[model samples]
Target: MITRSERTLNYAVLVLFSVIALFPVLLILSTALSPDEIGAGGSALSLEFGNFAEAWEQGNFGSYMRTSVIVAVSVVTLATLFSVMAGYAFGTMQFRGSEVIFYLILLGIMVPAEALVVALYFDLRSVGLTNTLVAIVMPQVAQSVAFGTFWMRAYFRSSSREVVEAARLDGAGHWRTLWRVLVPMGRPAITTMIVLMFMWTWNEFLIPLVMATDESLRTAPLGLAFFQGQYTAGTSLLAAGAVLVALPVVVVYLFLQRHFIRGMVEGVAK
Candidate 1:
């Protein structure tokens, strides 16, 4: 089934992309481990995450990391619950203006965050939520709902309906059928969504910047920005902070690699 030219072409493409993707990561890792004032000397210098400890202490990234975890977990948990319910209803139930309302929600996926972010700022201020962790978590939860709902709905749409129908005929309530039958069958999709949501929310920066003005509430990305303010210190610390900022995401992707692949396959099949 394999032709030499075709196999060579595919392998060549993969190798090229692999290098493209890995180049930046390698650079970051090199930057992170470089000696103090390393980046200052030249771009070609070989380095590692040597200054990470100093950067960690300087950024107090432990606290920042904790805040990020709290906000990300909260947003992922809340969004997953809301999106699953909304998606299930939209996928399976008939309701007035369901299509229209879903289209409005879909608009969120296209709308740039910067466009509505100013309005969001004022609205949160009006509610006295500015500078609060809740402010950051809330909007992310809302935005995540759109993509997550669309994804879950796609999977649910392709799924077998027989189990659900039989449960309904056996007097199982709608929620019961959804919880017991649908969710179990949709594990692959759900796992994928969870990983995606966690990654997005974890990396989110703009909303947190606009919302959590308190120094203590600042997340890793925001904290990185503050960490980079060089009027007070050198850039080596900043490189260290960068390594910390990227570490958790890399670890998660590596661990959840299997679940992520299954989710993508299942959702595409749907």
Candidate 2:
């Protein structure tokens, strides 16, 4: 059905965007591999692979990575669980004040984090949670849950009524139906949410920056910022640190990309 000209045009557009997306990544890799001893005026084509090791050692990435992993996993796990339950309740179950409560929760998604961050920092400080992993994890969990609830609620609402009826007729409890019936079928959507939440939590900066004063509690991005500030002249090392911080996110996306794409497509079609 497509003409040759249209096909060529599509290919051209795809190739153009592909380069646009990859150019920065290639530049970073080139810079990271360049000799760390060279000044900023040096070309970025050297093969000094030891830049990553030097950056890792100098940046104290081990602690930063550990903190990031813990915060991200905790946030995603708690957020996903809470979002699924709230989403199912809002999407399927009818009750008094359901709409009001759901809207209240939805406001969490609508509100910008930047707007509430100062107040949130004060609240956490009042509770003596500052400079702790809990400070970083809790706020992100709330934010992720807000969006997750919205996403899962849409999925549950659009799911087959026949399946719900069958589960009910079999006398399955709400929890049973959710876990045994709906969840298995919702793997794509759930995985998509997990991948998204992980990326967001891993890359989060503002919360950690404001909440964590301890050098050991800094997340990867925050640590990278500090590393850049301290090592302004170490261009190759800075690039390597950037790559190290970003690598986990890339790995996670690659692993869940199929499910993430399928979920997004399905959500759109619905």
Candidate 3:
């Protein structure tokens, strides 16, 4: 019962917003492609593919990227596994003080890292974990678990009880029921959670900055900040570095976008 004019208007509005959101990305890409002398405002007619190489080498992004990958992968894997177990428990099963324990974990989501980073630094330092991969990965895992538990819990809560009951009737244990059944069925939701956790873990700055003083321990975003300060006059290099730091997350999202969108829509619908 929609009119053609209304549909057209909606399309026009969507196009406008899309362009607005994409503008900064386009600008950064253009600037990254521009020559050093011409800077950000310069034309991309002269595409400088070498800017990325120069940025990569000069910024030591090879090391930063490796660190980011290690941290992100570790955090995502741990957080997702823990989140699934916790979410499945909270969403499908009941136990003593379950609500209370779940609410306590939820506090992590509400608390800002800025408020805890200083204290967290002392805690890690006391344990002699500062400047170590464990320091970087563990805190992020905890942070991610908070939100991941919440996300997966929603999906599990609204999951098909009939399927679960059937699994039980088939003599499938909780472990079998989860891995053999619900996990496969909940792919979209789990994938969405992975993408989100990867993004957040990859981009985290404050905790990495405070906990690690080792140059090799710097995450991509922290490296970018230092790279920016060092390359204040090198706009092309800065833009290229920005793109490099962001490319992994972009690639991840692009690959998982279908599942990501489906999960979001389903979550909302449910």
Candidate 4:
């Protein structure tokens, strides 16, 4: 069914796109491994391992890595739990105010994090939670839960409603039905949400920076900002730090790629 010319053109386009998309990643990897002492003389092609060595040491990445990991894990866990709970309620439980609550939650997407950050900072200051890991993680979790609840709710609505009814017929309560039935069936969508929330939280900068001034509480993005601010110019070390921050998320996505694609496709199908 494929013509030779068309096939050739497709291949050419794919190759072009692959290069365009991957060039930055390749550049990051190269810079991450380049010699720190090379100091702009070293080409990306001739990168050594010294750049990462210096970056890790100078950036205090070990501590940043720990803080980032803690924040990301906490945000993802809390957000997913809250989202799933609310999604189940909206999708199954009947209530007069369901539509209103759902729409209000959906409105969260319209509100930019930056717009509310000023008020959020002062509110946290009043509670004396500023400059703490909780300050960063709490806001990110709330933000994640907002959209996450909507995503899962749509899936729950369009997904196997019959199964839920069957569970109820079998005397399963709401919690039991969600855990035993919807959870397993919703794995594809849930996995996709997890990947999304994790990526967003991992890369989120503004809230973490504004909420937590302590270096010890900074997330990867916040630390990256500080690092960039300290460096304040074109340098491979900052690029290497970015590489370090990006690798984990990239690795996880590669592993869950199937679920990610499936979630989107199934979501659209529904």
Compose the digit string of candidate 3's lDDT tens values, residues 200-267.
78889998989879989999999999888876644878899899999998887788877656555543
What are the clash counts of all predictions, listed in order?
Answer: 6, 0, 0, 1
- Model 4, backbone clash pairs (residues 3+ apart or across chains), number: 1
Which portions of model 4 miss their true places by more than 4 Å? 38-50, 232-236, 258-270
In model 4, state the lDDT of residue 166.
98
Model 3 bad stretches (over 4 Å): 1-16, 38-47, 258-270
lDDT of 4 by residue, 10-128 (tens): 99999999999999888877656656654765665556655666677878776777899999999999999999999988877799999998888888865778987899899989989
TM-score: model 1 vs. ground truth: 0.83
Please give the ranking of all candidate structures by lDDT, highest first, separated by commas.
3, 2, 4, 1
lDDT of 1 by residue, 1-270 (tens): 889999999999999999999997777676666666633443433344436655666568887999999998999999999988988988888999999998888777666678867998998799887988778888888888887888877777887888888998999999998898898888878888998888888888888888887889999999988777743444556767877898888898899998766655654422
The CA lDDT of each predicted structure is: 0.80, 0.84, 0.86, 0.81
After TM-score superposition, the amount by which residue 191's alpha carbon in candidate 3 deviates from its true location, in angstroms, is 1.0
- Each prediction's Cα RMSD? 4.8, 3.9, 3.9, 3.7
Candidate 2, residues 99-129, lDDT tens digits: the string is 8888887777767779878998898889898
Q: Tell me each candidate's TM-score.
A: 0.83, 0.87, 0.86, 0.87
Worst 10 residues of 1 by lDDT: 41-50
Q: Indicate the TM-score of model 2.
A: 0.87
Candidate 4 backbone collisions, by pair: 33-48
